[model samples]
Target: MNTIEIKKISKVFGSKTALNNINMSIKQGELFGLIGADGAGKSTLFDILVTLSAATSGSASVHGFDVEKDAKNIRRIVGYMPGRFSLYQDLTVYENLNFFASIFGGTIEDNYHLIKDIYEHIAPFKERPAGKLSGGMKQKLALCCALVHQPKVLFLDEPTTGVDPVSRKEFWGMLKRLQEKGITILVSTPYMDEAVLCERIALIQEGEIMAIDTPVAIIKSFTHPLYSVKSKKLYQLLKDLRNFKETYSCYAFGQTVHLALKNQDTTAIIIQDYLHGLGHENIEIKSIDAGIEDCFMELMKKTAE
Candidate 1:
């Protein structure tokens, strides 16, 4: 069943449109991702679905309960962990978890099994004030508190935004475990790599979903040939490639520039030779597989067109 549904949903803040006719559905036990950069309206959509805010128009529901009409009931079954750290900083780790549990009529012991794996990582610092904890540790504690009540649906907005790579990987592992327990998760992240980890992702930009599909399917839809070109003069190469008539698009990707050619007639060797003529040494250009980020960039380009 669709655990969450949105149709023609739009949110406006006076002159700005936060969400424009957004539509998507998430199935039960699905780890769905809302991929977008900051100010892309991911947080706004989360607020509406969790009953924290009202939409300007259209409709949304969680578990078949209307977000506007049955907001109170929806709140009871959903756990929201906002992008910003909202836990009580002055309180100890143990106190914060217990406090949230009390609100849901649950004790730490009652839901220990649900969050034990995550809580154990933070238990060593249980007596530490939340404000004193490291970014990773605080993230663990916040997640534990969110799961304390065993809510059926969990909303995590950029949960790993400031977290370290190791902690981010560990957190995704914890999420996989939760999905195994049948908890529906709607997570938002700006990291394109993280979007690939979700079963399905909805790429949003400026409050609009550009594409919705599995990461693999999205990548497969990329029809253009992509190449990774690098040389000693990287910046100059980037500028030169952008001005090249045959270059469809050129953007930096790590140490190299990902260039999409306008047509297949010009080969990589031709581009490399052209750069070589421009006094660029150690030039390297070759076709590379497209990833989720590549697909996102392609979609964004199309949207701009």
Candidate 2:
């Protein structure tokens, strides 16, 4: 069963359109991700679905209840965690968790199993104020509160941003555990590396979804053979490559410039000569697989045209 549905949902703030003709359905027990950069309207969509804001037009529903007509029932069955920490900083960890649980007319012991995995990790910090805990501990506490009432649908906006690498990994691992519990999760993150963790992902840019599919399928759909070029003078190489007449598009990815060409006939030797002609030394170009971020950049180029 689909736990969340967005149909032609459009939201505009003053003169700027935040979301336009966005449509998606999230299945029960599925981990769906909204992938986008900043200002891509991820948070705006979250607010609409969570009933914090109303869409200018169109509609959305959670667990088959209309967001506009049955907001009270919808909110009861949904748990929302905003991108920023919204917990009371002065409250101790246990206090914050229990307080949220009580707000939903439930006790911690009533839904302990639902949050046991995440709560156990922070139980030792139960006495510490939320502001004093580590980033990961704070994250667990936020999740525990969100799940305290055992909502059928969960909406998380950038839940792992600003955390350390290990903590980010742990956060995603926790999400995987949540998915197994029959809860539908709609999460948005600016981190491309996390896209692969979702069952399906929607790549959004400027309020438009450019692509929607599994991570492997999206990466595989990337056409045009790509080449990664590296050199000691990385910046110079990037500048010279974009100047090449045959270069279709080129963007810096890590230490290399991922380049797509207009003519597949251009040999590596010709590319070498052109770089040498431009006085670039130690240039290296090799055919390699495209990553999720690479595919995202390519899709953005397609959308621009």
Candidate 3:
């Protein structure tokens, strides 16, 4: 069963269009991701789905409850962790968890089984003020509070942002455990690497969904021949490659530049010769598989055209 449904949802604030005709359906127990950079309308869509804000047009529902008409019921079944840290800064970790549980007329003990795995990490620092904890600890506390009511669906807006690498990995591990327990998770992140962790992902750009599919499927859709090129002079290599007549797209990727060609027959030697003629030494070019970022870039470029 689909736990959440959004149809032609659009949100406009004066001249700014925060969301543009968005449509999505998330299945029960599925781990879904909304991948986009900041200001890409991720948070706006989340607010609408969580009933914290209304769409200017179209409609959305959570677990068959209309967002506008059945907000109370939706709120009871959905757990939301906004992009920002929203727990009371002055409250102790234990107190915050207790308070959130009580808001639903329940105590932490009543739903402790739902969040036991996550709560164990913060249990050692239960008396510490929320604001005094580390970034990762704060995140865990917020998640425990969200789950304390035994919510069936979870909405996490950039939950891993600003956290350490170890913490991020541990958090994703926690999410995997939650999914195993049958919680439908819809998480948004600006990090492309994290997109692959989701079972399925929707790539959002400028308030519009560019693509929705499994990470591998999306990568498979990128049919262009791609090459990774590196030279002694990295910056100049990027600029020259972008200016090449046969170059379809050229962008810096870490230590190398990813080059897509207008003609699939273009050879590495041809590219290397071109760079060598321009005084680029130690040129290395090789065919490479397209990743999620590559697919996203191609989609954005196509959308622009």
Tens-place lDDT per residue, model 2, 23-98, is: 9988888899999999999999999999999999999888899999999998899988998899999999999988
TM-score per prediction, in order, is 0.98, 0.95, 0.98
- Which tens-of-lDDT digit does each residue in 1-305 have in candidate 1? 59999999999999999999999999998999999999999999999999989999999999999999999899889988999999999999999999999999989999899999999898999999999999998888889988999999999999999888999999999999999999999999999999989999999999999999998898989878899999998899999999888998989998999999888898988897788888999988789989999989998899999
Name the candidate, 1 or 2, with the larger TM-score value: 1
lDDT of 3 by residue, 1-305 (tens): 47999999999999999999999999999999999999999999999999999999999999999999999999999999999999999999999999999999899999898899998998999999999999999999999988999899999999999887889999999999999999999999998999999999999999999999999999999978999999998999999998888899999999999999998888998898889889998888999999999999999999999
Question: What are the lDDT scores of the predictions, listed in order?
Answer: 0.93, 0.91, 0.94
Q: What range of 10 consecutive residues in model 1 has the weakest lDDT sum?
A: 268-277
Preferred candidate (TM-score higher): 2 or 3:
3
Best by lDDT: 3
Q: Which stretches of candidate 3 lie above 4 Å from their native place?
A: none
Error of 3 at 248 (Å): 1.0
Cα deviation of 150, candidate 1, in Å? 0.6
Model 2: per-residue Cα lDDT at residue 54: 96
